[model samples]
Target: MSFEFIEVADMSTEADYEPKNIFLTGGAGFIGSHAAILLAKKYPHYNVVVYDKLDYCACIENLNEVMDLPNFKFVKGDICSSDLVTYVFKENKIDTVLHFAAQTHVDNSFGNSFAFTQSNIYGTHVLLECAKNCPTMRRFVHVSTDEVYGEGEDFDAKPMDEEHVLEPTNPYAATKAGAEFLVKSYHRSFKLPVIITRGNNVYGPHQFPEKLIPKFANQILRGLPVTIHGDGSNTRNFLFVEDVARAFDCILHKGEVGKIYNIGGCNELPNIEVAKSLIKILGKEKEMDDYITYVPDRKFNDLRYTITSEKLHKLGWKEEMSWEDGLRKTVEWYKTYTNRYGNIENALVAHPRMTGTSPTNI
Candidate 1:
């Protein structure tokens, strides 16, 4: 919940200028864990240190496979704690910061605006300050979402690109957009080597069950109905988790400083269709309608989101997982996970770390 920066040896000056010691926040969460694992395995010489708050959405089991690795480390703390953030960078001599920490759930953000602002906006400012002071810092990759661009497709307009104006429609998107401005300001005023990324809807394994895919997947397994927002016609692009991880890696190493890149998947579909597809995957196609319940739309739901990843593509990045394949893999992962714990709510409520019954990962 909180961390204090004690007298750890100040090794910031001795850090290598490259990404030797990488500091990644939110690394225990869905996208962060995937990126952490990828970086840990792909660059064994670099110390992949994950700093996270271990929120309800964060699961230590997500990093079980990489927990014992020589170069992998995890610190438990909130990013809002500037002292803790600064200590992590100075103590670890962290040169590269992959910022993935934030309040990501859109619906939750509506009611918990303070949490989003504190974590997403102020938390980013804390990290940027620490990063700007680090002599060995190379890249500050600020991971963002396409929702910052507001609604995507218009009557005849094409997908939004990097140059599109930022008009975030919801509290969560507003906080993220505000964070992006902070990153850009740090780059402009302090000359921090920063690059920002805006990606469309991301879905895959290890994701907390709060999101649509995993939530609905478990609901279907329990023979319960899935909740559909509004008319469920709102559209979004879904990128696989691994693909987003690779995109982050490419941006960290190859992307231009002070640039913003859009990472988007090719697949675009309606929300109801996505739920129906999941039902079909579960062999409950005949019960699709029976298994879906219409709910009130989000307070400020975006009808659609479309962002082009042309800039990232130019950096030699390409999506290797098709939506169909990606969705299948995601559904299977949830199936295996549900089988192990019987349900996500039970697993989260019972997890020692999440329940605050034990010390979080070191």
Candidate 2:
């Protein structure tokens, strides 16, 4: 399909005109997929080009809902390729870029930091370079994680704010932190219009089975044991995927250039409790306790990590879904996916729980 350039003001002449032609990296992944759909619905007049590498975690099935949308376009490419990224910006006439492409699994990051560094750090540099050269680009939104602030077990009583110093404990977070630095540097040195957002743990539909929540949900649905690392006391603030997507939309539309915003859900729960809650939702309460099996902890499992979305809230964006309702919907979606796809294990190679430093692990 040919790329179409859209003028934001054409959507609604009465509303303030926002620039269009959004270029989204990793738009096929779980959160990115939802973001693309939401963007299409909100701005039907604007064109959305999705650039994805189709990595292990990314699935085209996530885009089924928006496939027929005339404004949506999909491009198969890697963000780390400077030439490819540059070509995309020029060909699509992209005015805004939402960078969500990265190796995000912490366990996988520990096994092979190389991919994380290449994709998260160098890829970000490549995107920044493209944006620097693209005269039409107005906003470059860099999506990051709260893990950059490091182990927050000590601060469990309070939420971490944007000013918190980065003390990443894993390769994944380290590389993400590096990417954030690169974006900020580009904004300062080259005067690139960039905004950074760091959000807390996100869980929702279309998540790959490797992630904790989905993995456990899949196991429970299959009548398998849900593995809990080190008694599952680790706590985290969970944000719904849609809420995270909305946060990105808010940043793209209203965020100030060169600013960093923290997006998080006020909902916090321990890992064990979350698993138990899922069990209850599945109506397998009798097997709930039995389904949870304590496993060895990862090399450096952060006890807790939380973020305060005060800045994002001030921007007139707030999380609307309750944890209870979101969890119910998430569980139901996984059930449906499982029914259609059969066992998740059969669909993809299951990565072993991080146990040792074997080269092939994760």
Candidate 3:
């Protein structure tokens, strides 16, 4: 089945008569880029302004396709900068805000919890403050992750729901959980029109190669060994970037205020199985058993993270891409990057903080 990308025109006029002016943070990142593109294409009548810090995790190339679109504009700035964020709200006349910028690497967060707190916690606070002050701001959609629910080993059938107790394991998840609280607090005390979405691991094109799936795909395509943290039995639920993007559109347009939605995939696989699947898709199955190497796991690595997105599904959101299909497309995209870019050594150097911390060190 083909996926239906959401546009601004799709929102009912009864909710808000004028064409919406959207302010999106982290619009150049993986999932944000896709969402921006979909919004631009699907909602030709609306104006979409993107504000991003363009950190190591982001690239302007991600927005190349939508850069020239009439309704889309990008502003290079940080979310933590109150002056900059406030200026964006005032200058753009933004009707809604989609907050997506955050420090997301769990391992890195363990080494420097300060960075996570600054970006995830402080950055969110800045945006929330701006939205609260903007009388024109009708809604605020805060994007988050399922890692806030921590880990569990129940592979048989216990999926985390929206009501699940938050038990964040690492610094990254901890910071995100903190941010969620702040959003909720603002909604209750200040009456900010806010909603939150916690999703599973997201994979897709334009993703920086630090995460598991893309990292492994890039390495395997270059005939390099793949690293599996710990015994590789740890499992995670994966969602395609576009699916997560579409879920955001649903939440922004239809999700109830002061409510949190869990967006996740139906498929759950162990890390080792994920590696083997990539090998098969790359036609390197013979090297699957041999090319795999076990790296020491990160500090406080969660054993499993699964989510039940029934809340999002009930709100007319669904995962349209299957794991196999999504994996195939991801592999193809990474292959192109490898061939065109030659090597991403410079990109690695730019993000030195990522190299810090490992089970081998602490």
What is residue 31's positional error in candidate 3, in angstroms? 0.8
Give the clashing residue pairs of candidate 3, or none.
7-42
lDDT of 3 by residue, 1-362 (tens): 21121222323233523338999888887788888888888889889998887776677788888899989999988787889888878888998888888888766776677878888888888889888888788778888889888887566758878778888988889989999889888876777777788888889897877778887887687677778888999988888988887887777777776678888887789899998999999999977777688887776678888878888788788899999999999999887765433355533321224642111000
Error of 3 at 332 (Å): 0.5
Better of 1 and 3 by lDDT: 1
User: What Cα-based lDDT does every candidate model obtain?
Assistant: 0.80, 0.80, 0.78
**What's the C-alpha lDDT at position 133 in model 2?**
95
- Relative to the true structure, candidate 1 reaches a TM of 0.89
Instruction: Show the colliding residue pairs in model 1.
Output: none
Q: On a 0 to 100 scale, what is the lDDT of residue 56 in model 1?
A: 69
Off by over 4 Å in 1: 1-18, 153-155, 339-362
lDDT (tens digit, per residue) of candidate 1 on 200-267: 88899888776778878887887888888889898888889999999988877777766789999888
Clashing pairs for model 2 are: none
